[model samples]
Target: MDATTGINIAKVVGPSVSIATAGAILSISALYTPLLSNSARSQSSSKPSPTVTLPSIRFIFSRGSHFFPQAATFAAANFGYLAYYSANTAVKVLGMEMGTRTGFVAAAVLSIAIGPITGLMLPVCNNPLREMAELERQGRGDEVDEGELKKMVKRFEWLNYVRGAAILAGGVLGLAVVIAEGK
Candidate 1:
């Protein structure tokens, strides 16, 4: 390869790979640890505890705030990078050359799907915090409904998995394509 080509590869592929890898690590970490889903359980109990399970709700909510936002940031970055690569691809194809960017259009769309997932994630993360705070204000923490709380937390946790997988898939695929093209 020419020197300029090598430089371009280094500039684009190097940071893209690093960012993708870092985002994947963060996402997987959040999935395995309580960083996103409060439970280490392989599965939520088949029977959600009876009544307003305040402690469970609080646990997930507190921990959701702790790690989800950064994960969300990574999700955004994954989408942003995919969009960047897709733009490059579109331009190349339009120029009548096969894009050296190679692949990841589907991954890009999946990353965009994160938009709506995060849309759902917002309320799941925030509503609980607000509700809990309001409860504390009114001295009714016990009033949080277990069933509803479980549903909300489930949605939050499920959304995390969906986005995490998207981020990881998009990132890995992007890195692989860039590296292969670089080669």
Candidate 2:
């Protein structure tokens, strides 16, 4: 096979590998978040209420708290794919010219991806938290306005769709870059 054909295959495969890696990492991280939160609660309160066992793994997966970590994974996967293409291109053009280490490249790409995605989505996440706090302030005892809460939930849902679109675009762009630059 030609070098171009080889690079094309790598371009197709890299994102899938990165996504699988990121997803495993995020799953492990997510398990730890509840543990961390529970530990903090235990430390702060003398007698904490019984931990609410999530009804099912599916329910747990559906929660808003899960979205950030998933977004993080998506960002990391995209960034990793981008960096691999960038480095592979560099190597083709500058043989024996040391490019950035894979880890550094991955981190930098992930950070760049995360920065914009998080910046855009975090406010949507915060809306529900802020609304709940407002409900508490009004002495309604954590009972938020149903309509407002629904609006916040819809906003978050829209953000998720947008994130999915961004990921798709990143994947397509990354592939185009590799195809265009390949020998």
Candidate 3:
């Protein structure tokens, strides 16, 4: 079904999905890389490298602290937009003279679900950071045990994995919609 104007639905939604997918992948990398770097730095037996400044570490931490929410918001917004676009496309297809297509329906349904799932997961995953900050504000940061910190980190990582999976799934489903157009 052709759009009312000259707009191509595929062209718009295709890139939206791609952008959302790329953002999700980049966000995952950003979230995990520092943990790997810190782990390696801690495990090193050699004297601490003088080149790696504390300020640099703090800068990385600060960037990460801000990056997740922004990236998640951008990614989620794109997915949500894609969902809205796809739903409209589905309605258009249904009203078309050729009748309804299963592929468009599938895309609409998947898009509807993916937007909210991706949006919600990031904040849930970042809960540990909020908890830590709260403890610091309460003057009880020192009270948080290493074990608790480790558990929170683990939980965050796991949630990120799930979030990544959701993003990936959305990308794949979006691809399916693209491919279905070929038939």
* Top of the candidates by TM-score: 3
Error of 2 at 16 (Å): 2.6
Tens-digit lDDT string for candidate 2 (1-183): 865565455566645534443444344334432332232345564221222211121233346346545554554554464465455433221233323334324443543353476467667654453545445556663354434543443454455445444444444444444444554
| Candidates ranked by TM-score | 3, 1, 2
Backbone clash count for every predicted candidate, in the order shown:
1, 0, 0
How does each model score on lDDT? 0.50, 0.43, 0.45
- All candidates' TM-scores? 0.50, 0.41, 0.51
Candidate 2, position 37, lDDT: 26
**In model 2, what is the error at residue 160, expressed in angstroms?**
1.9
Two-way TM-score contest, 1 vs 3, winner: 3
Off by over 4 Å in 2: 1-10, 17-114, 127-142, 181-183
After superposition on all CA atoms, how large is the RMSD of candidate 2? 12.3
Candidate 1 residue 123 C-alpha distance from true site, Å: 4.4
Put the candidates in lDDT order, highest first.
1, 3, 2
Superior by lDDT: candidate 1 or candidate 2: 1
- The number of the candidate with the highest lDDT is 1
lDDT of 1 by residue, 1-183 (tens): 865555455445533543453465355436532322332333455424322333445664477556545554554454354445443543222233445344444344444455576677677664774575467457675665545555655555556677666655655554555554544
